[model samples]
Target chain A: MKIAFTAKGTDWDSQMDPRFGRTEYILVYDDEKETFESFDNRDIENEAHGAGPKTSQKLFELGAQVLITGNGPGGNAATVLQKAGVKSFIGAGGMNVKEAYKAYKNNELKEF
Target chain B: MKEIVIISGKGGTGKTSYTASISVLAGKDAIVADCDVDAADMHLLMKPVVEKSENFYSGVVAEIDPDKCTNCGICTEKCRFNAIPVINDQHIISSLNCEGCGYCEKVCPVEAIQMNEMNVGDWYISNTKVDNTMVHARLGIGAENSGKLVAKVKNEAKQLAEETNKHYIIVDGSPGIGCPVVSSLSGANYVVLVTEPSVSGLHDLKRVYELVDKFNLKAGCIINKSDINPEVTNEILDFLKKESIEHIVSLPYNENFTKAMTNGQTIVEYDQGELRDAIVQSWEKVKELVEE
Candidate 1:
């Protein structure tokens, strides 16, 4: 399964972004391939409205089955994720991407 | 015909009051368009009797047929606005959250979803006590597309002005620099920027003025309640001078404005004093500037 984290940078040491829709980067970790890929989310910064829905669509299209972030998606995005069957965990603010993944393994993150 | 829009960067800056008084001064020669559809209060002062009215439809919302639905979750997943939800094993569409994008209808596998045009508001052409035509609208609660409604009111007023050979169309615009305000500024010959002497008043004035400047519209400033804060008033004057915004009038704070509102009369009708005289002079200046 692939896991996605909203991050501030493209690396494992980058801090987890506290915002879902306006996150700077979306880092996906592939468990099977043991590889990390980052997608820039700066385009969403200029979105006048429906940023949450657009970000949710990105996650859906990226085929990320699990989402780990500081803040969960808003109502509109939440509906999309729920219907897409993606499990989400939040409350990872202040932690780096690697640390957040470790916390997820330890069940320290809250399910959103 | 010339269209003069009266807008305040912030609410309660006396935009509507000035519009009402000016309408009284203009009498039958000018028509009024109340473009503040969100919280339309011009009718309270104008006391317009509806001469003609029509329902305004804008945008569309999705509706699901329960009988045709195959309990498929595809529509819910495809809806970007989170408008569709499963209730008792049946997917239902919520009208309020729907953006009327019609994506759900397009993506519905069994053709269970249909897009319906939404009735957002109603527009009216009325006869006011001042012996003039007034075009206004009432937006539905929690409705979107107020900007479209404003456009409808302005168009109706413009057509009325042209047919009647009126010289001016006075528009009372919405507060802030949002979509409705932008719609109000479009195609307007002149803008009357009403403001107060408070800190936030000056800040929001600059913000709204930026929008007006972007539209390249000529604007004049009316400093209402100028005596409340002399320091801020001076700051406003300096900024206006720097921007070369014509200073049309400075009106002192008065309780009679409130009293006149409670009595359902314009300040020009209620006051025989300095406030009335200043508004009259300001209206004269506006007529001269808009004509030029």
Candidate 2:
């Protein structure tokens, strides 16, 4: 399964340290091999709450099955995600990337 | 006779706080309008007790009367917006997605589709504690026609200002440079762009500025929480200088702002300290500039 982590960062450097939309990083996890890769969501690099549906759609298009983020999707965006069949894990704050993936694998996170 | 709109390119940029504080300082001298029809918070700060309100209707929504209709999907085929959907054994129109284009009604073979007006929101004229009339509104959840609501609020504000012989009309504009913002800026004398000292702040500021310039309106900038990152603050200052946009003030990142908000008081009222003084000074300068 290809899972995408929608973090509040733009790059790997800032992705390691989460600060909401100020940082820039979207980690794509390939669950079959238990490995993860990251990409820079340049579109949301400087946006406040940049991990909104627009960026989330990009992640979905990149083949992400699961999205991990701090804030829940907005009303309109949530509808779009439901239509797109993308599962979102909201309120996963302060959890490191590896830990979040582990929780998802263990079916510990609830979908929004 | 000047209208100054306070707007932040993004939400939660303290636009309502600045508008409410300025409204207090300009007490009885201006007509205040909260034009942020979507997620309006100015009324929270202004504490306006609604003196009068009226239900506003945008366009008519098409409602299908299944009792009179056949199972034909003619109405669904004609709707370009895809508002019509087949559910259970009846064809239904989703009211939220309906643009009120009347295409479904026009194409209804059995004439079962009827356009019914729905209340989109409520517009109000209220009395605030500062002895001024405030025009604000609440747009219903999933409601369309926010531009219409914003226009109504601004029109009511202007009417009140003219009737009361007010010198200024202060508006708390919505975030983003969308239809509501356009409606709010229409016929405004000046605009105050409230922004933070962040990369996203500057980016959105430029986007909104472009929209304001498209309307040929004069605007100034205020850097809220300028102390968060001095490097980004300087970068913003340099950009403002390049664009010849006047930097009205640089507000430090102060916890008092949140505290004042929690207490439902303007910063000027909550703390008449240094930050309030700075805001007051900026308002004075803004008044002077707009008057010129």
Candidate 3:
């Protein structure tokens, strides 16, 4: 299983980015591989509409079974991710990607 | 044919009501286009009978093939929107999240992604209670490219006008100075911006006016509910005078406008008093101005 977290930096220790659609980077962790990968997401800044949906699509493509973020998955975006069978959590805000992942694994975060 | 669009920067300033009344007074010689696809309340007043309806596609989205699976993650890295998420050991693309940038398609190491266009909304051709036809639409929620939809609506209306040999196209436009509003403004011969007598109305009016000025379209103003605040009405008049915006008409506050709507009728059909007269007079003025 793979989990994705919106992040401010391209590393495991990067702070959690609050914005799901406009987050600076997305940090994904593969549980079986025990690997961490990150990608810059600065291109979302020019998106005028459906940013959340596009980002959710990215999560679906990234193989994220669970998503941890500060804000959303807005109403439209939540529907998209829901259809793709991806569950999203909204807690673990202000935590680094690693800490957020730990909280998510512990079931300490709130589902959105 | 002359195209006239009625726009308001703020909502609830009588845009649909006024457009309905103008269509009534303009008779069958006019083609009314309701470009307010965002809310689309003009149909409520005009009570159009459906003549034709069709789906509209604004843009294409990227789709992924899980069969040719190489988990190289190049598409994920190439996507700026973070739209590629892998699920259940199979990687897929979110059509909703895909901006259709086509960057991922080029970078996909295994040639997994393909771009596809999908229907995002519906457009309609309907016969109205006023003996004319209306071209309107309903944009799908989460639909992108509303500007393109607006253009489609206007183009249909213009085509209808030519087919019927109608000399007028009265467009009830969407609020704000966004892409839809800009789309409605394009190729229009006249723009009537409806605003009310309120602080926020004036502020939004200034914004809408700036857009009109930018386009350099021939413009006018209709101050609806002008009696609600005498001070604001005076200020609006003064501002228009200074800015050289034609004061098309100032309509007094009347519950009859709301009552007319509740009965599913335009004020011209429902009432005989001041509000109806004011709208009729405004339409006449618009016609004279257009003829000039």
Error of 1 at B207 (Å): 0.7
Q: What TM-score goes with each of the models?
A: 0.72, 0.70, 0.70
Q: At residue B158, what lDDT does model 1 achieve?
A: 71
What shift in Å separates residue A15 of candidate 3 from its native position after superposition?
A: 60
For B1-292, candidate 3 gives per-residue lDDT tens digits of 7889899999999988998999989889899999888788989988899999998876678887777768778888788887888788667887668888899888887888787776888899999987899998887767754656776787689778978899999999878877667667755678898999999999999998887775556789999999899999999999999989899999988899999999999999999987778788888899988766
Which residue runs does candidate 2 get wrong by more than 4 Å? A1-112, B80-82
Deviation in Å, model 1, residue B77 alpha carbon? 2.0
TM-score of chain A of 2: 0.72
Ranking by lDDT: 1, 3, 2
Backbone Cα, N, C clashes tallied per candidate: 0, 7, 19
Top candidate by lDDT: 1
Fnat per candidate: 0.00, 0.00, 0.00
lDDT tens per residue, model 1, A7-44: 97899999787567667799999999998999998776
* lDDT on C-alpha atoms for all candidate structures: 0.85, 0.76, 0.82
Q: Chain A alone, model 1, TM-score?
A: 0.97
Q: How well is candidate 1 docked (DockQ)?
A: 0.01
Please give, as one word, the docking class of candidate 1.
Answer: incorrect
Superposed Cα deviation of residue B30, candidate 2 (Å): 1.3
Candidate 1 backbone overlaps, count: 0
